[model samples]
Every structure is written in C-alpha cells, then in structure tokens.
Target: MATNLLKLNNIKTELMVVASPSQSKEVGDVLLNVDGCTIRPSQEVRNLGVILDCNLSLQAHISSTTKSAFFHLTNICRLRPSLSDPVAETLIHAFITSHLDYCNGVLYGLPNKALDRLQRVQNSATRILTNTKRWQHITPTLKHLHWLPVKSRITYKILLLTYKSLHTLAPQYLSDLIQQHSQPRSLRSSDKNQLVTPRSRLRTFGDRAFCVAAPTLWNSLPLHIRQAPTLETQAQMEHDPPGSLTLQLQGMRLSTSNKSVEGYTYNSFTLQLEGLNVSQESTYPVFLFILFSYLFIIVANLGLAVLVFVDKSLHQPMYLLFCNLSANDILGNSIMLPRLLIDMLRLPSERLISYYECVVQAFTSHMFGTTSHTVLMIMAFDRYVAICNPLRYAVIMTNRMLITLTVSAWGVPLVLVGILLGLTIRLNRCRTLMKSPYCDNAALFNLSCESVFINNIYGLTFTVVLFTASIGSMVLTYTKITVVCLTSKNKSLNSKALKTCSTHLVVYLIMLFSGMAIITLHRFPQYSDSRKLASVLYHIIPSSLNPIIYGLQSKEIQNFLSKLFKSNKVLASK
Candidate 1:
C-alpha cells in the first residue's frame, strides 16, 4: 500500500506522459500489485514546475519550455499594432522571458548550441520591441535598452545570487556551499577573502553544479561590485570598470574579432555631424558665412593679441588678461571650425571621420572652452583689485602673480580635460553619426556602449565648480565696483571707471548667455534642432563676436586701430 510507504517519488502532473517504449509496463505489474496506489502512464511528471525526463540532460524540459514561450509570444505579436511599448514589453516579459529565467540556474554550464537556442529567443524578443527589420543591427538596440547579453545575464544572476548568499542568512544552503579560502597569497587583494570553488570529477555535474559555477562568477567580481548592499545593486553593477569602455569590446564576447578602419583595428565608433544641416542650395552661402566669420575671428583675436604684445604702453594686467582671452579664442576656433568647414563641404559618401580624430576635437574644444572660463575669473579678480583698491592693485596683482594666473588659466583646463579625455578614449563608441557641426563631448559620450556614469559625474563636477567660481567672482567684483561708483564724489573718475568696466561687462555677458544657451540645449535632447543651431552659434558666434565686441567697444583697441589705419592711409598716399 502507498499510504504508509517511504518516498513514493514518481508523480505525474500533466497529460501525455513520455517514457521509453521498452519500459512501458503497467504500474500494477511494476509495483507488484500494490493495494492502494496506482500510476498513470499517460500523465507527465514535474518537479518544481520543470518537467523531468528519462534522459538527465534537461533537454526535453528546455525544449518544451521554449516552445510554449514562443507559442505564447507569437499570439502576443498579433496584438502589436494596438499595444504600447510598455504594455508589449510587459506581455513579453510575463509570457516569454519568465520561462527562460525560471530555473535558469540549472542551465549554468549548458552546451553552446543549447544556449544559442535560448539566445535566439531573446534576440527575437528585442527585435519585436524595436520593430527592427531582420537584417538591421541589434547590438545598439540592446545597448540602448541596457539589456545585458545572454552570457553576461547568466553570470550576473549567478554573481548576484552569490552576493545575497554572502550578505544574508536566509539561504543557509547557498551560504554553506561557498567556502572562503584559508590560504592567503602575496597579491594585494589575495587576503583569502575569495571563495574557493570545490572541484568535481564529473565534468557535466561539476560545470552545472552551484558550488563550482557560483564561486567562479563571484571571484570574477571586483571587491566594490561584490560588496553591493542588495541584489538589485549587484545586478546593476557593470561588467567592467569605469574607464573600461574599449576593453568591453573583447570582454563582452559579442564578437570574435575587432573591425579594422584605415588599417588600424579599433572599436567601431562613428560620430555624426549634426549641426551642418544646411541644404545644397544654401551650401555656398553658409560656406562663405563661416569662412568670413573665421577670417574675422582670426584677424580680430590675433590683432588684439598682437596689439597687447607689441604695444609696450598698453601692457598692463587688464590687457594681458585680454590677450589671454584672444589667444584662447584662437585655440578654441582653430580646434573646431576648420574640421567643421571641411566636414560641411565633404561629399555625403565621404563624411566619415576617424574615431580618434573625433575624440581629439572634443578634447580640444572643451579644453579651450573651459580655459576661457578660468581666464574670465582671473579677469574678474583683476577688475576687483583695480576698482576696489587701486592704491594696492599693483602690489596685490604683481607681474609674477599675473604670470602665475595666466599659467593657471592654461594649466587648469588642461588638467580637467585631460582627465575627461583619458576617460573618453577608453569608451566603446557604437554610433558614429555626430549630431553637431563638430564632435561635441556630450554627443561623443552618448555613443558609448558601456556605463558612462564616471564620465558624467566628473563632467558635472567640473562644470559646477568652474561656473560657480566664475559667476560668483564676477558678481562680487561687479557689486563692489557699483558700490564704489555710488560713493565716489568725482563724476569724471566714476565715468572713467564705468567706461573701463563696460567693455569687459559686455563681452562677459555675450559669452555667458551664449554658453548658457548651448549648455541648456545640450542637456535637453528634445531641443535637438535648436541644439545644432545653438552649437554653431556657441562655437562660431562667440569666437567671431568676442573680437568684434572688444574691438568696437574697448577704447584701447579702438585707439590702436585708429592709429594703425591713419598710418596705413599715410603709406597709401605716399
């Protein structure tokens, strides 16, 4: 009788049971006519919702589960036209992926062909969501959705399970399975904190077993990633380190070999030129416009720089700062505008640029742009000394001090952008269509396949600190100058002070507003069309207008130009 029996194990839960044809004997015959128990040979048996088969490979269960999932997915796809993306994603997850994920820990060391079968299901699922054609690229789509690949996902789950086991006591069996190594090594991190996976002789069982697979996955994790507070955080930890963007090409196991461009093997990254949106009809006009603007930027900024350098009488803290601004304008424009003009005129088929070149352009643009911020802060400090304490101005901002400030103006931006570029060059850029006239750092960053949180954090920190210091110093200096002007009894002195400060104020305002507009547009993708326009204006307009604004308004520049033009007229008459 089955009533008082020990371990009556073979139970059936579904119809259409499968067994070997040679062993299709009746239950009563096999049981030797046991009194109270009977078996249903036609019914299927399940353990933990996973059907067990005569073969121990788990092949039949995986096959049946996959088929059931696809059958349900095919029905769901028919409702695609009426389904929103979120709803469709929900349905796919509920019906298809849930089946794939269920008891997937048992699939740790499955054959490649078996894993490939499941991978095809995931690829199809992603394709369905994006409505991508069969032949179109899928890697970028997966990256955009932040979905880890099949192999990585398996590793992620295993490592996450290990993390939980280490941190929590609820899973006593899992915790006991992991044994920390007792022996220590000489290496820095080899303090015996690592879990030792017990080796097994049976390869099939060993590879699929939890003890072996879990420690292998756990040991691969960096200490920081392994120390994650929760399973969700552990799941979110990236497969590679912060500056490991380029390394992920090989690390991801997505491809066997890297693609070659111009005889050099590089991670494929194409930068799109977004700001050159002018039509064929308007090409020459735009070309001429940019050409003339560059010419004026060059002539104006260089002319001011030359004037400040050549004229001994005009050499002072103020004009030296102005010279630095002119020089920075030259540097910033030279980096971006030439490439932009070339790109704008290039044939549509020949528009592709080297990935390294794009990175260089982004670095230089940010370097000079940020240096301009630093120089302006120095200029503000100079103004504060001149206006607030004219008697001590020379002593406080001596020649040596000005030299140090100039060096800092150039040096500080280099350091900040060096860190940024160092991080940037390591990223795996998947998309190449640059969305601006030139390779903007922001657009370049957006194209990366790996986690750019470190890049983003550093950028945010630099911007906040630079802008805060620049704006705060300018406001404080201007406030003090205004108070001094109000308290002064001499109308002539106040008038002169206002005139001296007005040109600098006008230049600062123009640069400040243009910079703010460009940053705002950059931060918001919804302003895409406007961002392109703003980028062009930010790069060209400011460089073009800075010299014009200073040349037209500054008495020193105006006087120098007048004298030079008179000398030219005298020479022409001769």
Candidate 2:
C-alpha cells in the first residue's frame, strides 16, 4: 500500500499523469507537443471516449472508466498537440496559476490585502467547485480522499497547506506588511506627512480589506507544503507559523519582471523573458515641424496684413498676392499637420486611427489642400494678371472674384473627397503600441485589419492629379511670365516681372514638391525614415521658412518689415 501510494502521487513533478480506459486498441499514444500546442485528431485522441485502458491504479487521473475524470490526460493530449505536449503544459499552467492566485496574499514579501483578495477568490471558487455536483466527474469521491477537509483539524491543516503553496510560488513578496516591511530605510520626522498613501478613485478594493489581511495572513503562511499538517490534526490550533515546509512538487518557478514588448520562456526555478526590440523608423519630428512651421506663417501673414492695412502705400496687387499665398500655405498645413501631431501624441505606433479619421484626413486634407492648391494657382494667375496687365488687373481680379474663387476651392474638395472619411475598411488590426507620436494617414492605414486596396488606389490617384495640377498651373503661369519678359519692349517692367515670377516659382516648387515627395514615400516601407524627414520639411519647417524667405528676398517686403518693427518697438517702450 505504501509503494502503491508513492507511485500513485508524485507531487514533485509538474506533469500530472492520470489513467483511464483507452477508446481504441492502441496501447501507446502521443499525448502532446509542447511547442505550438495543437490537439490530436478528435477520433484518434479520444479513441472512442476512453483513456486509461491499462488500468494502473496510479494513472487513475486520466481514466474516464470510473465516472471520475472526464477530461483525462489523453483528451488534453489530442486537444493540444504542441512541442511541449498539451497534456503537460496545460496541467503546468493551471497548477502554477491556481496556486499563485491562492498565494497572492503576498505583496512585497509580506501577506497583504492583494494576497487576501487572491485567497478569498480561491476559497470561494474552490467551495463552489467542491460543493457542486457538476465538478464531481473530475475529483475523487469526497469521502474517500485522505486530505479532504473533515473535522476542524482537517480544515486548519488544509489551510496551512494552501499557505505553504503560496510561499513557494511568490517568494519575492511578503504575505503582509508592517511599517518596516518593504521600506528598509528610516523616515525623518518632517517626512511623516508624506508617508501616508493617497485616497484615490482608481483603486478597486477597499482599504480595510488590505489593512485587515496584512498582518494576519503573513505570520500564518508556511514556506513549504510538505510540512503542511495532515487531515488528522489539521484542525488543531498550531499557533506557531510554519516557515520551512518541504517542497516536493517540481515545476517552473515564476517571476514578477515588468518588462514590456517581450515574451517569456520558463525553466526550472528560473524564467527568461525577452526584452523589447525597438524599430529603426523615426518620423515624429517632421509632424512637429509641420505644426509649428504653419503657425509661424499664420503669425507672419497677420503681421504683414497689419503692415499693409496701416500703410496705404503697401496695399497693391503684389502685396495682396503675398497675403493670399501665405493664407494658402497656412491652409495647406492645416489639412494634415495638426492631426498628424495629435495622432503621434495620443497613441503608440501600433494603435490605428478610426476608419472615419483616416478617411477624413485623406479627404479633408485634400479639401483644405485642394483649396490651397487652387488658391496657389490663383496666386500665380494674379501675379501674371498684375504684371502683364496692371491697369486692367484691379478690374479683372477684384475682391469679389477672389472671394468667389476661394469659395470654389473650398467647395471642390468638400464634394469630391468627402466620402473618404465616412467609410471604414476593416483592414489589418493594428498593434496598439504606437510607433510614432501621431496617427498619420499612413500609420492608420498600416494598422488596419482589412484590405486597404481602395484607400491606396484612391490615395495614389488624388496625389497624382492634385500634385500635377498645382505644379502644372504654377509652372505654366511662370513660363508665360518668362516669355513675356524676353519679348517685351520695356526693360524696367520686364525686369520686375522676371524677379516676381522667379520668386514665386522658388516658393511654389518648395511647397508642392517637398510635401508630395514625403507623402509618396509612405508607400515604400524601406524609405519610411526618409519620408518622415521629408514630411518635416513640408509641414512645419517650410511654413516657418516661408515668411523668412519672402521677407529676406524681397526689398519691398524687407523695408516694410523694418519700419513696422521700429513702430512696434517705439509703441512698446512708451
């Protein structure tokens, strides 16, 4: 009987072997594969509802022969065919996990409220599982088990056994804490007020639960399970704490390592968890640049507006075009820059934007952008109209015409790309971890769970059309100016015309090409960094540079700015 008992229960091993009658004639079966745990074929593993056919008394844990264990080792083996064997790893997972729950009363090596919650939940679950008839098909008959809690003595002993299991699982933490428990250092008198914990809305459990359980659970917990009292004297008030119980169970130890973005592999008494591997891609600076740069242009344009209004001499077609171009650039940045910053700021690289946001950006960015683009085209046309036909320019490009034109620009984008925002394509489910600070269109598209075939297609089409139109109009407009200058009879007018057209061409190329190039690079995975850098140049940096470039290059604008600053400084000093 002693030999039989020893063979029947090897508590030290992580693998729990149970026996039952085999469903088929096969004597030996492949129970599990540890890696990639997948079950064996249904009929093959079940062998027709039987498990332990050999009938070894120790192997009774697997056998459904006696109405006890229905989910035997055999069924598990078939269910989880793994490199590590489904039968073994699952049993291991459950055993350690369940035991940890019971012992969590340990916090910082002391039995505390956290551990108490675990114990309470465990006891309640065990009570429900034990008392209900539904679980009986699994456990041995309640009366026949030697360790079954019987008298008060048996109950107390079982309680000790549970404490021992907890200590082994979470050795680093305390079962509960005292003032000197975790904080080994001493506190000064002035720091007393700082020592008190805050009363917060976030904590789930009441303070009393932890406060009460702290001291009680810690001292009573046993270090080892083998020393736990048997069913006979378990009820007796032992009074003394059990610190050194023998550990007979052999299994992988646990860890509380708080590393992020990594997985774990376990070994005996030691666990190895891989650390996070960061990606090489970087693009956040570009978004930031876009945001700040456009803001500066807005400020500079407003300043220029104040200067123009204050000085009647400065109010002319050229200055008006300058104001319009600044506005276009400001509006252009507004389309995509702010939201890109917001997305980067709010979530990690992995979290995808809502379908609507992606569509909205794709569409409205185009809207504000198309408006800006058309406005840019108008700016070029205005310059042409002014230099070529200065006398008729006022009548031709009146304020009303400009207003109607700006409205047209806004409306065209609203109508065409409007559908992009309302629709959501369930593309690839993005990893919640954000790669960049913002949720740019490309980032969201990448994170999608479904196919982005349409998004990409429409995106490409819009890019080519809008980009080509804006650049084409600006280039063609400037080319006409160059031709007019070469052929014209007046040297003074031609010189001014050449200078103005050339300046606009420089600004136009910088604005259009840089932004378009960055956006295009997003399609290629390998060039993401380069794309981000380009976006920075397009978004914030260019906006900042725009005012400076025009202010420095144009003699009329520089003289105007110098007088305006002198006026401001004089006003401030007064």
Candidate 3:
C-alpha cells in the first residue's frame, strides 16, 4: 500500500492539530511517514482551494479566498473596455463568482467582518461589469446581475442542498442531515410536513452546519416557493421583475433604470372563475338559490357531525366513519362554493387569482374530494365484512382496525394530491385566462405553454389508481357479500344484509359517477354551459346529499334525533 501510494500523481499531504484553548500550550508535534514521505505540519492547509486553519475561525480562509479571487477579477477588469456584456459576464462567473459560491455554506454563521471580505470581492466584480463608481450603492447592481448578496448566496446554497436531500434520491450521508418534523399540531396545513434542523452547541459548527441554516431559510420562504421542485424554478418563482424577493429582503425597493431581466417575463398570472350560464336579469335569483343551498349543505353536515359526536349510543365505527365523510363534505364545499359565489356576484375583473393561489385551491379541493371516495370504499368494506364474515367481523372491525383504516383513508389522498400539486407548480403558466369558473388540476394544467405529457400521464395514473384500487376493492367486496347472502340459510339474515348494503351502494354510485363525469369534461373540453353546470353540481351534490343519504338511511340516528328534537321542543315552550 505504501509503494502504491508513492506512484499517485499530484498528491500532497499536511497535518494540522485542532487544539482547544486549554490545550494550546500542551500539544507537541509527532512525526509520521507515508510511502517514505515525511508529513509536513502547518497552521493551515488548502483543500479544493478553501483554507482551513487550526483555530477554525474560518477568517483566514475567507481572507485568502477573497484576495485570490480579487486578483483574477482585477486582471479580467483590464479587458472590460474591449469585451461585450455577455462575454464579460462569462469571464466573471468563471473566474470570480465560482470561487465565492464554492463551499459558501461553510462560512454560514461567521461574523460580519469575515463576510465583508467576500462581499468586497463581489462588489468589485459588479463595479467592473457596470463601470460604476466604488462609492455607488451595490444593491441595484446586484439586482441587475440577478446576484444574491454574499450572505444570501450562502443561505441559497444551503437551502438548495436541503431541498435536494429531502425530496430527491440523495446519498444517505447528505440525506441524514435533515428530518421531517412530525408534530401533532402544525401552524398551517402547508407547514405540517416541514423538514426539521437538528441543534448544535458549537458556534462555528452550528453556524456553518446544513441543519441550522437550511431550515431557517426554508421556513422563511412562502409555501408556494418552497413547494418548487427544483432550485432553478425556485429562483425563477422568487424573481418577479417589478417587486422581486431581493427588494422585499432589503425592506425597500431600489430605484433603477427600467431594464429587462434576462429569461424572465414581467407578465402577471390571472385566472377567472367560470360563471353560471343564466342571463344578467336572472342571475340574482340563481345566486340566491345557490346561497341557500350552500347554507343548507353546511348546516346538515355540521348537524350530523355534532350528532355523531354527542350521542354516545351512536358512537359505533360505522357512525364514526359517517362523521368523517360529513366533515370532508363540508371541507370540499367550502373550497368550491365561496369562490363560485364571489365570481357569480362580482364583475369579471374581480374574479382573477394568481397562479400559485390557483394551484393551492385546486390541490385542496381534489384532496377533500379524493378523501371522500377513499372513505366510501372503507365503508363498503365494513358492510361486506358484517354480512359475509359475520363471526370474525368483531375482530376485523376492532377499534385499532377502525383507526388504521380511517387514518389511511385520509392520509393516502393527502399525499397523492401533494405529489400532483408539486408537479403542477413546476409548469410555466403562460396563459392568464381560464374558461372554468373554479380552478382544478386539469384546468390549470391545460393553461401551460409547454408540452404537458408528464402532467397528462400522471393524471391518468391518479385516475387508474383511484378507480382500480378503490372502486375495484368495493366491487369485489360487494360481490362476495351478494354470494354469501344468497347462500345463507336464514332468510331474515339475508333481508338485514340487503338493507345495510343498499344505502352504501347508492351513496357510492352518486359520488363515483359525479367524479367520473367531471374528469370526462376536464379531458374533453367544449365551450358549453353544461361544463360550468357540471363543475357546480360536482361540488354541490356530494356535500348536499351526504346528510340526506346517511340520515334517512340510518335508523338509529333517526330514533335519537326524533327523541332529542321532541325534548328540545318541550323545553322551548316553557
């Protein structure tokens, strides 16, 4: 091994002991040899052109790197009079910017004086590019060049690394630095699955560590920006020409000549909610009718949820699942109706929403709706067991079983919708106007200027997984239940089985076909009043019908509500 090491090319070795303040005077050098080469001892060593000192202040490294970068930049500056803008930028990026960005995250949490040296190198480069005086402010120059400040560049580097580590197929060592924060309560749904940074005690270690700087920078970004899948797109989303992120960071917008930023368009994103086909004269009556209907849906679902919550006798797994369905109904309607109402009653100009906001609304609406489908499938499975496997039903539907099924019903849909939303945000939405009244994945995806094969393929994948897994499960479960009922010796048992399963089938058909119809319309678009009407019905029918389906079909709920209402009436008369 020693003879083999001697044959290696361009390799040099050094030793530097990192001793604490108390051991500063006690340590002595020890000699070592590798391939008959004596190890040289020094206070600092340069690896990958970054300096590391024994004290670990990082000050010496910063000073050395800045000096070297500035020396190259000054030589490039001498040719600036002869070079064009693009050529000059290429030279600066190759020589100067590359050095500053390399291992910048290591300098994180260092004192301001250490950063000042690097900042001075950057400022000099900007001055050479713009031919501006040294005394002039550097903010505008940085913005024009689309360069983040030295501190911001460090943060950007760390955050980009963290994003890749968490979302992409990263190596195990880098991936282990951050963990998803799993808390019972989150500030917002968007914040629920944030990556947590581990704490450290050493100031330099903590400051430059990936864990400390990454989470702070990641959390500081808006949810939409953080949701961006790539560092390139994240930077693109953050760079709005008129009021950019850099301006927001400074707390004041800088005044500069109106120059266009390369590779960015100043166009604003706007989406209009689709309106009802009714004429202006009849719009008010339709609006009023829709308003009353929305209120009734909310009141019915809320009342059912409360009944399930308060009535101890009705606290069975089936009723608890009904409560879950009703809650989802309320959520789905809440996402769609308020915006629909606002668009119907207001002028056309008032109906516009930004691209990111549209993505969020579309994501949430689908999440709740998909969750409802999953819960319905679970209910079907529940009844199938009660009828087909009567003896083991108790064991199969235990409290632990019920909790696991319920959590999966909600959890699976949330993750699926989040994946779809993340992919949708990456698309460049060039078209501002949408014909649909409400935003959805299909509608917004169609508005993108680029080819949408990935989006199309994923949409089909979602539909297949949802229908084949969920609906197929329901069909198989019900078919088995039918076979068992016909084979049963007891006629009364068969009658009881039919009654229980029929209600669930009816509810399932209503939700399944409504969802299928919406997807059909979304896939094949034609300008018709029916498209808008279908969207309205898709949002309305499931929510409004949930209470009626469960309440009328449920004998126990009817008995409890009848006695409770009568008792309330008697008290009111007094």
Candidate 4:
C-alpha cells in the first residue's frame, strides 16, 4: 500500500528502520522486497543533513557536526591572518556557527558528552574569532561575545518554536502538536500563559519528541516572558543575563533569575537628537522659529476647535469632523514639540526623558497621527454624502452618526496604539541613544537587542491596514463626489462642493506627502538628517497650517470671525 501510494504521488522512496538499542536485537536484519527491489535496513542513515543511528543516540550526528565544523574552522584559521576582525567574525558565523545552530532544536535532552562535542566547535570558533590561546579560559570570551552554550541554544530554539506554534505563526503540523493550558474555572495559573506538556511513556526517545519537549521547556520560562505579546519581547525578556553562561558551563540546569532578567531596567533615557544641525550662532534663531511654530500650532488648532464648539452654525457634520481633526493635530504636536523646545534650551547631554514619559510620547504621537488620518477619511465621507446625496445629507449624517464616527476615529486608534505601546514598552532595550529629536515608535523599537520580526510584522500590518482603509475610503468617496460635480447641471452647487472639498483635499495631500516622505526617507541611512527634519515637519506643519487653511476657505468660519471683530469694534466705539 505504501509503495502504491508513493507511486501514485510520483515519489521515489528510500526507507530505513530506526530502533532503540534494546529493540535492535529483536529487529535484526529486517529486509523487505518492493517492486522487485530488495531493501535492507542499515545501522545508520543520513536524513536532512542529520545522521540517524539505529539506536537513536544522536552520537553520529554530533560527531559529523563537529568534524564538519572543524574542517571549516581550519580553513578559516588559515585565512585569518590576512582577514580583518569583522570579516573573520562574519566568516566564522557564516560557516561554523550556522552549522552548529542549524537544527540544534532536535538536540534537546541529549547527554552532556554529545552536547560537549558541539560546544567545543563553538568554543573553537569564538577562540579563532578573538585569537584567544588554548591556555586561556573560553567562558569569559563566550560571555563577551554573547554566545549561548550548546544546551542553552537548544533550549532557546525549542522555546522559540513553541512560541511561534502558540501564536499561530508556525506550520499547522507543529501548531497542532501544542496547546495552551486551559481550565473550566479561574485559577491563579490561568493567566500564566502555560503550555500543556504532553505525557511521554519513554524517558529516552518519546520525551525528546517536539510535542513533549517543547512544552516542558516553554512552561519553565519566566511568567513575564511567556506573557509577552511578541517574539522579540519574549526574547528580550529571556535573554542571557550575567552568570547564565557560568551556570551552563558548570553542568547545572539553566534557570533565569527574575532579578537578572530585569537587571537592565532603565528609569530614563538620554536622547541624542540631531536637530537642524545648525551652528551655535544659528541655534537660538532656529529655536525661536520652532518655538513660535509650536505656539502657533497650539493656539490655532485649539482656537479652531473652540470656535467650532462655541458657534452653533459650525456644528454641522463636516465642521464637527474638522474640529476632531484640529484636536488631534494639537494632540500630535503637543506630545512632541513641548519636549523638543525644552531640549533645545538644555545642553545636548542634559536632554533626558524618563522611560514612561518616552513611552507615553510615542504612544500618544502615533495615536493622534492615526486619528488624524481617520478623521480626514471621515471628513471625506462627510463631503461625499453632502455633495452626492444632498437631499438626504441631513438624514444620513445626523448628530448620532457624527458622534459615533468621531468616537470611533479616536477610540480605534487608541486601542491600536495601546496594543503597540504595550508590546513596545515591555521590550528590554540594549541601547538608550535615540538619534532623532523626539521619541517615536521606530526609535523606541530600534533600541532593543533581540530580533524584532514580530514587532515589525505587527507595526507594518497596522500601518498597511490604516493606510489602506483610510486611503481606500477617501478615494472611493472622492471619486463619487468628482463624478457628481462633473455630471451635475447646477453650476452653483458644483462650485460650492468643489470649494468645500478643495480645503480637505489640500490638507490630506499635504499630510499624505509629508508622511510618505518620512516613511520613505527612514529606509535610507544617508538621508537621516532629512528624515529627522521631515519627522519634525510631519508633526508641526499640518497642525500649524490646518487652521489657517480652514479659516480662509470656510465662509462660515470667515463670517463668524468677521462678525466677532465688528461687534468688538462697535462696543469700543460706544
């Protein structure tokens, strides 16, 4: 049947039998005949670059790995004299370390004698990279290089795979093998993010299966690590702390200390901002310009919001969305500019921010930015309804609908940003220096030492979703509005619709272009200064200009301001 299935699938098969040492005697000389081909069982077979023996002891695999690693190490050593340090390190990692780490997860629960063989290969590579002599100890050197010993590396691999499986990021086969611990009732351990460790009947072979071993190691991790929202955060929380290497080398079981894991906790961070990079003579003038710009952004956005709230005529749906946009602008700039202004007055070295403050700044800034985009999208929809369905505009865009849209615009971004910040704030940072003048999600993310694949995925997903939804909605609405304006016979209505939309279109275009420039420039290291300037402008320019643009374009606001000024003049004359 197996041969028939393989034939049906067009697969050519070579089969082998792997038995434990005790069963090998009973299963001696097993042979089979299929399709006129005689196949005899072998003592050892190479599968997927790993040598599997009949006893399943893995000794053959270790010997093969060490032999291959030493071969490359010897060649690297021969060329080491002429190679630079960085090049030599890269070569060692590419050749020796990769071989050692590849598929090391399967090496879990291996005897010390077997693991030591792989460890020796790692020691040799590190020694060769650092030019350390045979007489010297390799422990400190390995610690300095931040290399985890073979056993610990195996554990890390297993735990990482387990995390991926739990998060649905792994293959379905792997995911099916693992399950999260659950109970019918609330318990103290319910929230611990524990995995269900499957029972294995055999201690030697069955226990080493991924299903059994993965959960065993995963459940042993710190609670904080297991609860981490992303892989990078988990890695940072589980990173090797001081003395972990020594424990591994001493043949002791690896255990993480809560204190050591949290030892790198920072109360504050110093920002290394690259402002306009002006000379000392130009610093104050530039500072003054930025200061006044901030002042204008605050006053203009707040005043516009206040005017919309106080005036009954401007309480329409479009104006209400505009007011929300204004509030978001004020919020976005206020999160960044006040600190920026303060930092300008202080010495560069004195520019410090508490950890929580930085997190809050990043959270609020991104939240408000997202809110701005959503508000603009809502505004576009508002204009669409008012222009295309003028007779039913009041019915469709009622006060209840407007309030709901407004609340969602703010609430949805808050939830998204909150999740983002929750993940980001828990990351263990390896560095505190930020090159830009402000705290942002990208800057905060770059400070972590671990791989941020999950964070990047989530952040990119959020950005794509926001951009797609907002841009798609605006495009669809505006297209309908354009069609209405062009096809309509009433010239007066067309002009009014066009005038109202022109202001929003201008604002949206400015925001879209500035945001795109910042996002694009961030990918190139050479344009770092330009990127920083663009980031600063992304916050301030829209806020500072939105009020001026709306005031000049909207007749309702213009007439309201004119009336107030004329009334003040009449009161003064009386």
lDDT of 4: 0.79
Report the Cα RMSD per candidate: 21.1, 22.3, 21.2, 21.6
What stretches of model 4 exceed 4 Å from their correct place?
Answer: 1-276
The deviation in Å at residue 113 for candidate 3 is 44
State the lDDT of candidate 4 residue by residue for 182-272, as single tens digits: 9899999899988798889888888999999988877776677778899888776675575454332112345432212211212235434
For each candidate, give its TM-score against the true structure: 0.57, 0.45, 0.54, 0.56
State how far residue 351 of model 4 sits from its true place (Å): 1.1
Every candidate's lDDT: 0.71, 0.46, 0.75, 0.79
Ranking of all candidate structures by their TM-score, best first: 1, 4, 3, 2
TM-score of 3: 0.54
Who is ahead in TM-score, 2 or 4?
4
lDDT per residue (tens digit) for residues 63-169 in model 2: 22212212332343344444244444456336433333222221222223223222222222232333422211111322222112112122233334434334453
Rank by lDDT, highest first: 4, 3, 1, 2
Top-scoring candidate (TM-score): 1
Better of 1 and 2 by TM-score: 1
| Candidate 3 Cα outliers beyond 4 Å, as residue runs | 1-270, 572-574
lDDT tens digits by residue: candidate 3, 301-323: 99999988899988887888877
TM-score of 1: 0.57
